[model samples]
Target: MEMQRIMEFPDRIMDKRPRKKPRLTWDMHPPPQPQPPIPPPKVLPTTYHNQEVVNGVAPNHAYPSLFFRGLTRNGSPPWRPDDKDGHYVFAVGDSLTPRYRIIGKMGEGTFGQVLECFDNEKKEAVAIKVVRSINKYREAAMIEIDVLMRLARHDINGARCVQIRNWFDYRNHICIVFEKLGPSLYDFLRKNSYRSFPIDLVREFGRQLLESVAFMHDLCLIHTDLKPENILLVSSEFIKVPDYKFLSRAMKDGSYFKNLPKSSAIKLIDFGSTTFQHQDHSYVVSTRHYRAPEVILGIGWNYPCDLWSVGCILVELCSGEALFQTHENLEHLAMMERVLGPLPPHMIVRADRRADKYFRRGTRLGWPDSSTSRESMRAVWKLHRLPNLIMQHVDHSAGDLIDLLQRLLRYDPAERIKAKEALRHPFFSRDPKRHGYPL
Candidate 1:
């Protein structure tokens, strides 16, 4: 028993060896203590080369070079290259076809930019619409040109449409020349703080608009996009627009006009969306606020569509806001019901399939059950609020104006008054002794 405990020890215990600890090396030095993150490089402030004060403030950072490239040392027109990339670059002082000298940008639109220019040959100021050099815009511009050309051939004395002086292709763009005009009716409204135009003014505008629209319809052309913005004053004397920026600032101020002019000559402009009477147009042609019910119902529309738009325009002139003030089709339909009474059952039944979602089945006049529909119903119930609203902004003697609006705004296109007939409406035939013959 004393022969030592080693005699009985297992062979596995003798074979086992002691483990050794891992040694630390320079390569494994705790990832170099994660050296403090290097600070980011500071961005230098951008300095504009032609920086100058404009309206007592620094020029727009987006267009600092706009002033430097478009003027000569003596502040005169300067010629620039005609082409940029695949499009035309119309500079402030560029020569267009050696006939007109660019003065400045008058305004811009979906099809093109209108430039105020001096017609060197004609010895008068004119407007040149430089259409964007794209296929769709070019096609639209050509259609406008064709319409204007046809219009010019008529040469009726009282035609209230703009005349196209000339048109030619330059640098892949269709450049159309027109008589220089004043601000738009929309601008006039803006200058007047969105206040309703005087009753006399409203009548005169309505007459002019009717005359123009009637003339267009007679010629089998429909102005699909008629609005305040497309109606322009015939003279700049009424509103002095020194430059686009000045006009913009004046519009923003809302006090541009201290007193309303007794009258201003207006001409219908922008025929890019005009169509032939026989053509089937897209339902979404007119501006949403002024769109006709027939168009909204997806039923076929005709010349009467323009009459509906005229009603809307007249309402805006008298109320300082859109008659329907809605974009959604259902809400628009609801507002129409509130103001004009529910659409006729025949109209609702014959409407495009899309309209069923707005109407209740088997009901002569019922809106859907929804939050918006309920709110619209409540609005209809409280429509008495409109009397005070109308009185506050509209200084017009109501007289036969309401009747004329109703005739023009009827849901049935056939029931809508024709432009020629509207010209003879009692609204326009007010007693000369009382209203002074509305210009």
Candidate 2:
């Protein structure tokens, strides 16, 4: 069956440049103000497992708990609790609104804590993200809730994005309930000792991701943060819930499950950094490794930025490591140019005033006359080509995959392939069923 095509924005709309921001500041708006603290919620005893204890605290207790799960002996999980100073004080067996029963801490982020809970009314498990009582976090939580609500209104290519079960204010904290999902792609990769996924698996994940992104872009929403950590696995019959003791052992051994299923669906999560396509977003929105060139250059970005991130993610999935691994902007740009070739002169010229620090006049190269010596700069630029790099890491030689990656990684946002267009690419057109695989 042919996939339904999502309408694309007009060329004029896609080509239109965003309004210029102040040359001095990269932020589009001022940071949120701090608000008076709200009193903590009162916890009531529930009839659940009263003997269960989490972090030395009995059930229905409230105290800051430490939950750390390492990916490998040397690798750490992305979400680590701040034991020295943390605001997440919810405990297992605690009841929220008398409908949801907190089971255990799933994860934690900058703005909130995620808890695995059971929904009494629905008789199913759900993930609840409880924002900190701080006013700034509360506001961000509301924005995320709004985005999730809008996204849940539609299904893309018969696959639904992560659903928002419900949201409400509980004890001065904004709590968002989402459908339960398994570990993130980051966790999956880490569990397998950073081994690259099979080609067919990558194709399945890539297709769904493109559909999800296209669905969001169709509604003018841009997920500024797109990475392995944010892509979660949809729970399946093959998935088995690991007990806390088993998880602790798996963290040390770097093996979560004995054998991973042949296929599993995925969903995009974490909408805190999401915004309208037309909004002027902060230049430092995406993670450093997956950030788009336009974002690094401070050129205003749009929906195409998300596609750029998808390109980075696809490469990481194939290589089991970031395509560009650097915290410094100049070094990051150097890494990108090494693989993708130099940025277009026109793009460099249109960059913000900060562009002067990296690029030289009448040159496509960067890091001009800075602390780094010319010899070192030349050496860095002489890195491996894209094809050679991919061939060395990825086990497959499918030309279609390479073609799609090239289009998605274009330096010029206007020239970069849109998510909807990517869905129609020959890479996804191949029938997985013919290969004896169900996607």
**Against the hidden true structure, what lDDT does model 1 obtain?**
0.65
TM-score of each: 0.72, 0.73
- Model-by-model lDDT, in order? 0.65, 0.66
Winning candidate number (TM-score): 2
* Model 1: ten consecutive residues of lowest lDDT: 1-10
Candidate 1, residues 172-285, lDDT tens digits: the string is: 567778877666776555544455566777888899999999999999999988888788766533322222222556455433333344346789998989999887787678
Model 2 has a clash total of: 0
Candidate 2 on 32-121: residue-level lDDT in tens?
A: 232232333433321111112222222222322112221221111122242433354655555665567666676767776787777766
Instruction: Name the best candidate (by lDDT).
Output: 2
